[model samples]
Target: MTTKKPVVVELYDEIVFPDPSEAFLSRVQGHPAVNLPRLPAGVTLPPPIPVEDASKRRKGDTKDHSLTQWFTNFSEADELLQLAAARQRVQAHIAKLRRQISLIDGQQQQFKSTPEQ
Candidate 1:
């Protein structure tokens, strides 16, 4: 029988809002003085710039081989790199511990086999 790996799925939505200044203008320019409805709790408003415009601006401003830009702009990449390094370190430590445990077990077996002098 073959075991199948589980598939993981993630969903994300991107929202873009005009800058605060623009929102402010919209609020102030409203001809009616009716009280505006409140937004849902924990719901955040997006910035004024459109998502496409923001992406274009980021691409234009960043250059290849820029460490700060890479670190700041690509958190998923940075996190993966960090996780890889951590896994390597953990594996190394586990191997060392295994060797130490084996050595201790061998010593214990040897001492047990030797008759009390």
Candidate 2:
């Protein structure tokens, strides 16, 4: 018989994670300089996902929403701002990677079309 261990989710200050390691906790705790942008007038935010509800989701269920889904309420303003900043940083990195890939592709095509020595 196999025994299933209970999932241990901990919330330290505002960071929530299941079974966190020391390294993970160290990296994420307390970055105080984050500035959360105020929601513009007439903007409709998506409903926030409760931490309990999120923990109950199946492994593949998480991919259906944005990173902001968990912090989409007025109550979670700081978290929402932190998530938004992270999203912006990631998008910038992705754009840089895409540009590098395009440059590499162009070089490959040019090399293929050149006359053999």
Estimated TM-score per prediction?
Answer: 0.45, 0.37
- Identify the candidate with maximal lDDT: 2
User: On residues 1-117, what C-alpha lDDT tens digit does candidate 1 reach at each position?
Assistant: 446876779998855344558767677658497466676899655534555655665343433323443245545556678999999999999999999999999999999999997
Which stretches in model 1 have alpha-carbon errors above 4 Å?
1-24, 28-74
- Candidate 2 residues lying further than 4 Å off, grouped into runs, are 1-75
Clashes of 2: 0
- Tens-digit lDDT track of model 2 for 70-94: 4533334555688999999999999
- Per-model C-alpha lDDT, please? 0.68, 0.72
Q: Would you list the clashing residue pairs of candidate 1?
A: 17-47, 17-48, 18-48, 19-48
Note the residue pairs that clash in candidate 2: none
